[model samples]
Target: MTRSTDSWIQQLSTLMGDFYQLLAKMQYLDLDQGTIDYPPYIDPEKSVDTILATQLGINPEAIQLLQRLPYVAAPARWNHGAGDEEFVLYGCFADFRKDGELEESRDPLYASIDPKDESVGWEDEDGQYMRPWYVPLSRLGNHGVVLILNMKNRHLWVIDQEGGCSDPGLSDVDWNEDLVNKNSLDRYPSRPATEVLRDLMQKFISLEWIPGGIHHGYQHHHYKRLYLAHGWPDNFDSPAFNATRQVWEDEERAQYSAERPFQDVDRLELWTQLPTISSQLARCEAENASPAWHAQFQGGSGRIPYESRKAELLARLPGEQQRRQELLRELEQARRDVVGVSGEVRRRREERLRLDGR
Candidate 1:
């Protein structure tokens, strides 16, 4: 029960049974005596899972995909934040199993695969071997904050409604005794919201699943939480959504820093744009079935090789049909425009000949 980092980490040593059990309780009610809580950041009111499945049109399979790490694409979910510098990236510890196989084993033959060697990556927003997992140990059933994991470097980035000061963590909290209140940093979770993240980082470090992978690489470093005020850092692994930071780097960033100092979003506006957002997210998932993607994840990346290729590809057929339909529409419009132009030209010629009295 010591408050030091090393102490609690030693207690949560194993990544199996207890990890899942403890992690499961963090998502919902702690006991019957207390009230059931829900995250406020998503809709007027809805759990992260419900919002994803209902509003976003994400199926159950997609939710399961989100739970898996080195996911076909970068995964994401909705949840409330503690408001005062707190957010949840909304994934689970289950991500530790990259396809399958958990238990502090799987010594990858190679470490530090070149960023270029892998076909799919989070583009320029991650370091080597650092899978860009959109998850974390942020408070659930609260206000809102998002913690993005770059385990490749043992670092975390927090995106809150309006916070850019010293980051806070959930380590050393006595979940049994603590009373978690929404929208406050001092209020700790009765659940292990923060612990999930810290423990995962510990496992990553202990198993040497980082960039080094038991080699003399980037394994010595630990994790740190930072305010995602600007955009992603230098590089990230996985062909994920590395949204262009350049657009926000200048005017928008300065505006937030000087004026608001938080990543703000209008929920109504976002809802209106769901079609565009959903399409983009689907595309990210759809692109991950490439042979190179599987090879990188299964063949050498140290985890079990991807086994559900056909299922994933089948899921993408709808997107393929949608794309084909869009192309046909464009082709039809082009033909109509050509016919209209030809008719206009003929009419103009006839009018000139009549005027000339030929």
Candidate 2:
């Protein structure tokens, strides 16, 4: 092996050791069956001597690096929330080889065209190059990031649906640092497979160490906040958390409905209920004068009664009607102004023509 290759192998070994230790500490191997005897290290160079070797034109160094890492068969349930699942890392590119040639069509990440077609490669609408050799490293349920390695440059990339293998601006020398700084939303380049695995293991450890908090709903903003607060949980399958989140979402929906009772009502439906709403609004306004009503509504700090909302709606109806009338009047005025201007222009043109004729 070249000096650089030797260095990479050594670094990979250290990272693998760290990752193995983390897995052991988390008792992941114990939790999952049939992975106990899985080899801890891979000899990427010699390991690719299989029948399919001739088909895959991948560098031996890349293969060796892939083999050095552990292949997770059954991913452990690390989280129990919706869309938050354990990260499963695996290496399997045999399907890419068919009839002793790279079958680009077999992989969804890559284009369906032939790999030998140098004129084209996988890319987004913006024409940014997406590395075709994306080996899925970890997944959060059905969705997750894939690790792509540039065999020639020996640079690693982490990509997903959100962002493909494109780094914002970071040097290759500090690749691991850049990866560590990346948030769950970011898709950027990182260190090789072993280092990336080690980083993921660290994140898993951090998440496991954090004591479970109040379940937040599964909105993007909520999820982003939670992810920032408590790194993405390795597993979100906690029945308790899931139940809590569901209840929270249900409450939110109910509260939204309570706040906007007329939101679902059509114009005809709203008109039909106006009389009743007006009567309720009057009653609510009258009740507002009483201390008991104030206490019941907690001085208007708590949820506003439906009666109060109805009253507000009734009050705003006339204003909305007046605003519509005002808009109609303005539109008529604008039409008149346009007509007058056109007539004036025509008269001036006629006068000028008459003067020229005279």
Which one is best on lDDT? 2
Q: How does model 1 fare in lDDT?
A: 0.32
Once fitted onto the true fold, the runs of candidate 1 whose alpha carbons sit more than 4 angstroms away are: 1-143, 169-358
State every prediction's TM-score relative to the real structure: 0.19, 0.39
TM-score of 1: 0.19
Q: Please give, for residues 224-343, the per-residue lDDT of candidate 2 as tens digits.
A: 344344323464333445455456557656654443322323333445455456556655665444645644656666466555654665576565555555555555554454444344
| Residue 5, candidate 2: C-alpha displacement in angstroms | 0.7
Superposition TM-score, candidate 2 onto the true structure: 0.39
lDDT of 2: 0.42
RMSD per model, one decimal:
24.8, 25.2
